[model samples]
Target chain A: MGEFELIRQYFMPLARLHGSSSVIVGPGDDCAVQRVPPGSDLVFSIDTLVEGVHFPVGYRPDYLGWRTLAVAASDLAAMGAEPSCFTLALTLPEADELWLRDFSLGLGNAAESFGLTLAGGDTTRGPLTLSVQVHGVVEQGGAIRRSGARAGDLVVVSGSLGDAGAALDYLPAQEDLDADDSAAADKQFVLERYHHPQPRLDLGKALRQFATAAIDVSDGLLADLNHILEASNVGASIELARIPVSPALVRLKGSAATDYALHSGDDYELCATISEASWVGAPAWLKQQLTVVGEIEPVSGLRLDGSAVVSGSEATGFDHFRRKA
Target chain B: MGEFELIRQYFMPLARLHGSSSVIVGPGDDCAVQRVPPGSDLVFSIDTLVEGVHFPVGYRPDYLGWRTLAVAASDLAAMGAEPSCFTLALTLPEADELWLRDFSLGLGNAAESFGLTLAGGDTTRGPLTLSVQVHGVVEQGGAIRRSGARAGDLVVVSGSLGDAGAALDYLPAQEDLDADDSAAADKQFVLERYHHPQPRLDLGKALRQFATAAIDVSDGLLADLNHILEASNVGASIELARIPVSPALVRLKGSAATDYALHSGDDYELCATISEASWVGAPAWLKQQLTVVGEIEPVSGLRLDGSAVVSGSEATGFDHFRRKA
Candidate 1:
């Protein structure tokens, strides 16, 4: 099918199913017109995933569709913004029918899960790359920023980390592994964690009233937290023992799980700093998913287990260009 | 340099130079936060241009940078929205410092010309591709859309058409031709037209009060106007002789200039439909830049010079995927 036909057959329906009322005009226009709620600020971020670089070649289209949107939405989750809408720019080598179908299905599922409207997008012919620009709304001046953390703020993280990083080792073996194999269940758990990592939108919204600073952990805990520290001009001391890791990841990597939790990327969990008073007063439901792993300090560096570590070091996290070296 | 350093060196400065007051949080965060003025609606669009597919390999990075942002901003013009901000997703095979410096210079220049803030974006390693998402604001309920054209509306277009299309022939020869060559000046003009086609932002914003429908002429006159026709459920009768063409293009293509004007893409001019009364009542400044090339009709197909033309026929315009076949 041609570009228009592909969009009509696969994407138009998805837009209709997931489009929000805020979308004054949806697809089929040069621009999508949307109404930002009165008194709300807008937050947006763009993310691109290139095949063979961001993901393995010939990865499942559905999982890719899910992964791309989830990854982009995680930025909104970090900003404590309510999900609103997004535009996708997808470049592909060919107009593959089945691929487009499955991709749109997964994308639609993600749009529904994240409560975003499909505003508009551009599809072009090229090497496979997907760029999603997600927009969200936050109360005026209520967006939690990385620069807001102050000394004495408690650094916390939502959900477990490092499963996606640990899952990397099992990706190539996924097809050959038997379902009844002893490691199959553990492998499946980590693989699912890799493929379908959830963006903490609800938790982010909840933190808006309480958190002093926030960031999404796509570049590993140490690297991403360094962003918060650098922006706020503060430091953090993370208790390595308090870092949470999924049982599946621990089972798969054992002693290496803590390292992955600290330095591996693509977890999509929100790492935020909250005032000690606010953390203590935060609702039980909110605190239940969060683990207080550290505290912000006046010193301007990252400390782990009482030792200062260099930020942006090779051991800190994944760097697209650095990986080449 | 890693992605962070590259962004800090090249992109962050551009963001600061073009950053609008509305941008609450700029680059270096998980998301950029911006305040949408109350009583206004948001307009956004995304466009991707891939190397080799969209432009020639080894094309001037600066021109590519300007062209990419201009092409994306054209969508905002089509919606009759005031330029606001944009995010860029840039992918590259390698970190070429000189290429990045020149590209960012061109991009920053365009951002200034179009009054757009560099919000935030992602950079990744891959084949070269740029996906720009532009956001704008329009008065509440005042966005001009393709669906609003009426049968009696007069079709109008701003500036000249087909120069960019005609310029394609000069691209490969740009380097070989001597500066003193007879056709050098004309080739230079057309090439500039291709590389720096102006988005009709002022024209679009002026049309917000009077235009029944509007679209940017990207995919040739016929193909793009047909979009307005289809969306508004109306037909059009275009006077072939009335379609404006640049003297440079006419000199280049002779009698074939008319065909190029009708069938070539990437003009970045605004094609709008307004009531006959509104067209007459429009200010002289607005009328000067526009040519009355056609009129909307009760029928549901396109007619050029009293003859019906198939909208998506191969002769009409360019289709990225269709070109492969």
Candidate 2:
């Protein structure tokens, strides 16, 4: 199929699934025209995933599609914005019909799950890469920011922390896990967590009412949480025992499980800070997703169990061009 | 330098150059948040350029950066939307500080020229690729779209056509042309057109007042005009003698000058359908940019000089995957 044919056959169908009321002109135009609800702010973000560096070459197309869209959507969640639509800029080495079909199916599933629609996009021939830009709407003055955290705010996180990180550490051992029947389920669980991270959109929306600051845990809990601290000009003291680690992660890497929770990245869960009063007043369901792990302080340094956090490969999370070489 | 340092030094300055009032939160965040002016619609588009496939493998980084932003911005112009802000998703093989500095300078220059700012973006290590997503705003019902073309409307284009296309065709001859001093200035003009074709922003905005339909001539005049025809379910009769050809383009292609005007892509000029009454009322400065070339017809085929348009290798504009084997 040609680029136009591919877009028509695969992408165009995805656009038709949800007829968004806000979109004046959707796909098949030079630009997708959408209306931002009056009294609302437009929230937008772009993320690119490249072959080899971001994901292994020849990775499953469906998973790759889901991951690219999900990761970009996570940024909207961090801002407490309701997703409106997204545009994709895809680069592929060639046009493969079967691969394109599966990828679009996965992309459609993501759009459906997130309550957003495919607006418009560009497709080009090149090395395998995907860039997704998401647009969302937030009520005026309701959007969350990393710079809103106060010195005495309580830092919290949603769900488990290290499963995705642990999955990355043990991905190479998947082939051998099948031989050991006992490890199969855990291996599948961890791998799925890594491949399909659930962005905390609902939790973030709830946080808009109570949280002082917010960020998505993309580059490990420590690294992402530190972003909130640095932006807000404060410090944090994380309780060593409070970081949530899933059973699958602990089973996969036993004694070093907490290390992954602290430093390993790709956890799309959210990290936020709230006042003590808001934490106490938060509804039960909302509280269940959040676990208090630390408290913000006046000084500017990260600490664990009252000691400065200074030792570990995972301490700083992954940096693209500056990763240890 | 680390990704953070690189952004602080290069990207952050671009964001600070012109403080955009619509931007609620700009850069240094999970997502950039901005407000769409009340009673306006948000218009957005994304475009990706890959090394080798989109341009030469070792193309000038500064020109590459400018071209990437300018081409994406052209989509906004086609929609008759005012440029607001843009995000960059850049993938690179390595962190070459010098290359990054020049590229960011070009990107910053484009942002300043278009009156937009760097909102937010992602950077990673991989094969060289740049994906830019531009945001614009237009009155709720003011966006010019391809589907709005009507029969009897005059097909008009802004500025000269095919300069960029001719430049691409004659680029290899540039080195040889330098030996012939007479061709030097034209060579430079054509090369600049190829590398940094201006987006007709003012023309597009003006088109909202009089154009029934509009599209940027990214893919040759004939091919892009066909898009408006197909979308609006109309045909066109293009006057061969009326097509505007620049002196440099005519000088370079000689006998094939008309062919390039008819079929060359990437001119980045505005091709729009305007009612005759609106054309007559248009201001002289705006009228100077527009040249009448054809008329929309009730039939369902494109023609030139009373004959069907066929028998040309460059008949269709470029398609990503279908251009060539």
Candidate 3:
């Protein structure tokens, strides 16, 4: 599709929305104009999901749209930024009406659910790639960062992980968790995670009130958390038993089972560090919604109950560019 | 390089620049947080430059870094917003240190050249793609939108067009430019426009004082300007004889006596419209530096004399996605 007509059809309408005072100008100009509240900081992040790479190709457009936006917003959750606005850059092969309609509906639902406005975006025809620029606001000086995790911090996670990764084992078109969901609870859990992964904005904002360091478990618990540890230049000995294994995940044994949660890349759960001297209890919302998985330490290198954990590329976690034939 | 090292070596240092107050929270987080002035609004836009799409494959990393940022900043320029900060989602196949060093330098130079600072970004192992998210600010209720152009408005352009399109004949390498660059002036001018485009942030902000509507000339003079006409529900007659042609472009088009400037893309110049009543002379910085290319009308459809523009599948000018053969 020509850029003009495609943009006019999909984005022009998104631009005309119920105006908010904070949104000085919405999707039509060179930039989406927004106002950070008096005591807030504007938080921004950019992510690109390439076709045949980030997501399986020929996947349902609606799910793809929901997942793409959700994946980008999860970063805000990781940083404890309250969602406000987002801009999407969509590059597709053509303006397939069916796909565009479903995708738009999916995006609309996500935007509505997160209370964010589709502020601005660009539509182009390319190799079916989607890049999302998401914005949120944290209190003037309260946004949590990966580098803030120091030694003696308590590491925790929002909700369970690995279900999205597990969902990949099912058929690609299996959009619903219940449809063809095997008796395997783990399988169902994985499918659910894939279909509707949650962004823990509530838990993240609560952490801004109490936690020290945080990150979303996108790459994996070990790999992603290792980033925090590396940034903080320290590590911890996790109580292997403290790991919150979902019922589906707990059933699997050996490398494959643990690999799903440890290195599977789609989980967007937040992996955060709390101050040892901070309050002993979490907010009720977080408590009902999250699981305490591990604690930070003064040591270097990741470990499970004082033992180091091994990584299996399983061809799952490595960068696709360098992947060998 | 791995993602972490790329951040530490290429991005973190740039993000640490305590330039303006907009950079409240920089890199080292899931998102970059900035502070918008009390009476100001945040302006943002996202654009992606893909290899073999936006630019020729095997193009110089330095120029790639520069042009990508320039194009995205041009959007800010169109909206009359002041450059504040930017985030980049860089996807590359392998860890090419030398290339990355040059790319980072170009990006850093561009960031510092404009008032914008490098806030935060994502570097992943994938196809060679650059997604830049640009942030700017406009005073409360002071920004330009395409929909603002109306009947009886003067259509204007900031600079000469088509220099970039001509330069593209020398693709992927700088050698092709050597044969064409018999004269020093011609050679340097062609290379400059192609490699390092100027984002007219100053003129864009200045337009807020005198222009009725504005947009950056990205796709082409005919296409991008038509965007204004379509949005304003008005048409315009542009004098092809009055179209501004760069010195290098004039020399290159001497044989064909062609006016590729009317249809060529990648100019990054600002195209605007001003009402006859609101029309005032542009600032000195703009008068000698910018061009008043044409005017607007009350009818619809873009025209180059008597011809109507048609969409296509070309990879360069106006190529949303050039299909692979």
In order of appearance, the predictions have TM-scores of: 0.97, 0.96, 0.89
Cα misplacement distance, residue B31 of candidate 2 (Å): 0.6
Tens-digit lDDT track for model 2 on B218-312?
Answer: 87888798889889998899998899988987777787888888777667899999988888898998889989999999887789899986522
Score candidate 2 by DockQ.
Answer: 0.70
Which residue pairs in candidate 1 have backbone atoms (N, alpha carbon, C) closer than 3 angstroms, thus clashing? none
Write down the worst ten-residue block by lDDT for model 2 chain B: B309-318
Judging by lDDT, tell me the better candidate of 2 and 3: 2
lDDT of 2: 0.85
Q: TM-score of A-chain in each prediction?
A: 0.97, 0.95, 0.89
DockQ of every candidate: 0.78, 0.70, 0.50
Question: A123-159, model 1: which lDDT tens digit per residue?
Answer: 9999999999898999888899999999999999999
lDDT of 2 by residue, A1-325 (tens): 4567678889987676666556667888899989889899989899999887777778788888888899999999999999988999999988899999899988888888887788899999888989999988899978999999888889999998888877876566655677557867877888888888788888888899999999998888878888888898888899979998888888878889898888766769999999989888989999999899999998887898999865222347578776531
| TM-score (second chain) of model 1 | 0.97
**Residue pairs whose backbone atoms clash in candidate 2:** B218-B266, B220-B264, B220-B265
Docking class of 2: medium
TM-score of candidate 2 on Cα atoms, chains taken together: 0.96
The CA lDDT at A276 in model 1 is 90
The residue-level lDDT of candidate 2 at A104 comes to 91
Which prediction has more favorable TM-score, 2 or 3? 2
**Model 2: residues with Cα > 4 Å off, grouped in runs:** A172-179, A310-315, A322-325, B170-179, B310-315
Kindly list the interface RMSD, in angstroms, of each predicted candidate in the order they appear. Answer: 1.5, 2.4, 3.5
